[model samples]
Target: MTAPVLEMRSIVKTFPGVRALSDVSLTVAPGEVHAICGENGAGKSTLMKVLSGVHPYGSYEGEILFEGSPCAFRDIRASEAQGIVIIHQELALIPYLSIAENIFLGNEHATRGFINWNDTLRHAASLLKRVGLDEHPQTRVADIGVGKQQLVEIAKALAKRVKLLILDEPTAALNDGDSAQLLRLIGELKEQGITSIIISHKLNEIAEVADSVTILRDGRTIETLDVKAGSTTEDRIIRGMVGRDLDHRFPERTPYEGDPGAHPALEVRDWTVHHPIDQQRKVVDGVSVQVRRGEIVGIAGLMGAGRTELAMSVFGRSYGRNISGTVLKDGREIGTRTVPEAVAHGIAYVTEDRKQYGLNLIDTIGRNITLSALSKVARRGVVDEHEETRVAESYRGSMNIKAPTVFEQVGRLSGGNQQKVVLSKWIFAGPDVLILDEPTRGIDVGAKYEIYTVIDRLAAEGKAVIFISSELPELLGMCDRVYTMAAGRLTGEIPRAEATQEVLMRHMTKNTR
Candidate 1:
């Protein structure tokens, strides 16, 4: 029998007032794709962090063995020195730097205290080619799309001569084509005798590429299953992570009564938004959409299809330039030219990039939750701290935000919990129309169901919801009606009964110039 490449035994890591990991163990064989499956806050990422020395040696109690040798790494650089490279969920490349520069930022091609540009670009070009990224090494990283950025991240890892490559939510920001290319690259790397440990919530991707699967729940190792033995089904893995079989992926919603056209809760007409920098380029071309009271409408499209642009433009002219749109609420025109006006007009938008645009990372959960509507918790023009706490506590309970207290920092919470806080903030604002953009992105299956349930409940409460997602099944499962977009144009609209992956793909790829 071949010896294991990596082994982590009895790892325990903790934060203030929270135990992130507890006596968790993982084993990875040489040249095998190992997958770590878990729900949000399950310590999947924490375990990898410990292995990569992000937590250091003394910060966590654990025994790590690499290539049958006991290892004690103090920092990320120490781990990288031993051919262990970790690509975090958030890509670490600097946007302003060139691709080659970003790839070898810290590990530069230098000789005798002098940098070698020739060797750097040459090696970066080769690495980019190996990763199937067809781009000039000197190209500015900011100019490229997210899919390319992901490739750049991999190329960066490969530059380190990585033996045990660790990727956390690598495909979270990628579209289908990009995701497929990434997975194929992983397979190629496996063939080359490189071991990989991938941590992701996308179970299909896990089932597709993983050789062995380790399940973690609430800071403990549940079990590890061998994929080749036909034991790692998506549902089975989900059951292990969530500790129960999820009978339904999405919550059932009561059908909206009456003709949807009879009472349009929110409507956008002749909406066209130009690119922010490139004024002549229209990101969101002449498009119009309507949502009725008590209806959950969905926008399904590929990356760069302008779904987010459309929603942002409609919400508060948040994106794009040269915007021309008329927003109507209950047959009355409303001014949504600014964020404050949009909110006052009963329109709330939950952004896809929660860490970036959704929440104040340094602030408390209570503060972030009540940020959108402070007036409700204010008295005599003074912010009432007790009322704010009460309101935030109410949302924390209803939204299922898993935090010890409302005083916990928002950044300290998991992706799903942070998302719930974002939802809570907007819902507290008491909006008649809510726009949820990739609300469940990077979240686990269990959290997704909760988010879906919240959306359904909002629709039931007579709130019009415009749900935008890149996942076709999510759209088909939770949406009452799904609209497809391509090239900034509405391609097709399919009702729940008529929607399928095949049909949605057809419309999503439709050339609607």
Candidate 2:
């Protein structure tokens, strides 16, 4: 029998007040796609960090064996020297740098004291071609879409002669077409005798590509299943990761039953927004939407279908240029020309890119939660820290933001917890209308259910909700009515009972004038 490619024995990792992982063991075979399935805070990322030497050797208790040889890596450089490379959830490429520069960064080809640009670009071009990326090596990283940037990241790993590749949420930000391409590339890599370990929340993608899956819950190994052996299923994986059988992925709620004649809680009519850079190109063109009180409306579309642009533009004109729109609340026209005005008018937008536009990562969770509504806790131009703590504590409990205290920095929390913090912030603002953009983008299935429940609760309390997501199933499960967008136009609107992946796809791909 062939020996295993990697083995980790009795690994235990701990923080100041929390034991993140306990007695975890993992084994991976050569030239196989291995998947690590776990909920947020279950130590999946921590284990990968330990293996890649992000936490170094002495900081954790573990034994790592790579190709039957015991390994002690003091840093990521040492791991990379052994043909091990990890691509994090966030791409590390500099936006302004050329693709070739980003690909060979820190590992540039040089002849003794002199740098070699010719060899660098030549090698980068070959690597990009190998990964199915057709762009020129000199193209700036910012010029390409997110999907291509992911390919560049893989090309960077290839530049290191990587034998074992680790990807964290590789497809979280990619569209369906891009995700399919990346998965195909992974299969091609397997055919080339390269091993891969992927940490992903997308179970369907795992079922499609993984040869073996290891499940973890609360920092311990639950079980490992062989995919070809007919022992692995999405439900079984969910059961292991969450420590319970998630019979229902979404919370149940009553459908909207508002009167047709009554005005919607929020309405946008003849909304048009042009691209910020391309002055003449329209990003959102004459789109209209209405959300009745206590209703959850969803906008479904492809990657660049203008769903996000429409939401951002409607929310105090945060995005786009040459914007022309009329927003109405309770049948009366309201101005949303700025963020403060939008908030004052009881409108809140939870952005998709949480790290960039939502939370202050360096600040405490308490501060981030109360950032939007400081006046509620302040008096006579004087801020009260004690009252702020009390309010944050209340939200921390209500939102189930798993943390030791509200004083902890927001950056230290998991993706799921960070999302909860963003939600808590908007909820504290007491908005009558909420626009949530990809609220569960990189979170686990268990966390998704919690977020759905929060949305349901908000709708139940008579708040109009506009949910925008790329996943069709989420729209069908949560939204009362779904609108499809194509080429900056509203293609179709389907009631929840009539919505399906097939029907949504047709509308999403429809052509417009």
Candidate 3:
């Protein structure tokens, strides 16, 4: 047997009131694709941060061995110097910079403190080619799609001459096709004898690509399964992560049978939105959608199909230019020309990009939850601190936020907890029509189930929900009626009884006149 490439022994990491990891240990074999599986807040990211030196040495109790040698890295640079590179779940690339500039941001091709543009571009071009990206090296990062941006991140890692690569939810934001391509790229990297440690909530992907799996639960290492041994199915992984057998991926709900005479809770008439940058291009072309009370309506589409544009444009013109849309709530046309008006009219939009648009990470949890509806907790233009704390604490318990207190900064919470905070803010706003864009994007299975349960309860209380997701299975599993969009047009609509993956996909791909 060959020596392990990396080993972490008796690792312990803690925050002020929370022990993130407790006596956790992991071993990765050389040239193997190893997967770290756990529920959100189960210490996967914390362990990786420790390894990558994001937490630094002397801050935790652990003995790390790399290439059979004891090493304590003081920072990320020290780890990267030994050919280890970690790409975080939230991409670290600067949006304003060009692809070449982002690839060589810190590790530049320079001489005597002067950048060599020629050398940098030349090296970036080669790296981009190696990652199968065809975009020009000088193209702005913001102009490219998320899939391409992911490739750029990999190119950046390659520039460091990485021997061991760690990817944290690399495909969380990517569509299915992009995800497949990335998994293939991982396979290719494995073929080149590069060891990889991938942390992901997608069990199927882990089952497909991982050679060995490590399961962590409540900050403790449970067991490591050898995939080659043939007992490491996705269901098996879920059982380990959640500490019980999960018979179904989705919770059961009473189906919403459509009624022609019933009035919709929310409706859009002949909505159209031109592209924000290019006014000549119509992103959403004459699209119409409606959701009845106590129903969950799903929008299914490929990336760039303008599902997000439709949602944002309807929700107070948060996106696009030249937006011409008539929004009706309870059969009455409401004027939602701005965000405050939209909220006043009982409409809420939960953005897909939580970090950017959903919550204020620097603020306390209580503050973020009260942000959308401060008027409720305010008296005479003064915030009622006691009332605010009471409301926030109520939601923290009801929504299962999992934070120590409402005083904790939202940025310190896990992805699942942050999403709960976003949901809590809007739910507190008391919107009759709620648009949830990719609500379960990067969360784990356990957290997803919790969110789904909350959505189901909301619908049971007669709140109309607009659920948009890149994952078709999620739509098929949760929606009462599914609306398919392609090329910025509403291609088809299917009832839950009639909706299947095949039907939704066909409609999603069909061209509209």
Best candidate, lDDT: 2
Q: Which ten residues in a row have the lowest lDDT in candidate 2?
A: 106-115
CA shift of 481, model 3, Å:
0.4
Per-residue lDDT of model 1, residues 276-377, tens digit only: 998988888888898898888999998889999999988789988999978899999989989999999999999999999999999999999889988888
lDDT of 3 by residue, 1-513 (tens): 999999999999999999999999999999999999998899999999999999999999989999999879999999999989999998998999999999998899999999999999999999999899999999999989989999999999999999999999999999889999999999998998899999999888998899999999999999999987898888899999999998888889998765768879899999999998999999999999999989999999999899999988888899999989788888999988899999999999999999999999999999999999999999999999999999999999999999899999999999999999999999999999999999998898999999999999999898999999988889989999999999999999998889999999999999775
Candidate 2: lDDT of 239? 91
Compared with the true structure, all predictions reach lDDT values of 0.92, 0.95, 0.94
Clashing pairs in 2: none
Residues 342-443, model 2: lDDT tens digits = 999999999999999999999999999999999988999777899999999998999899999999999988999999999999999999999999999999
Error of 1 at 79 (Å): 0.3
| TM-score against truth, every candidate | 0.98, 0.99, 0.98
RMSD to the true structure for each prediction, in A, is 1.0, 0.9, 1.1
Structural RMSD, model 2: 0.9
Better of 1 and 2 by lDDT: 2
Instruction: Report the Cα lDDT for candidate 3.
Output: 0.94
**Model 1 misplaced stretches (Cα beyond 4 Å):** 259-261
Candidate 3 deviant stretches above 4 angstroms: 257-260
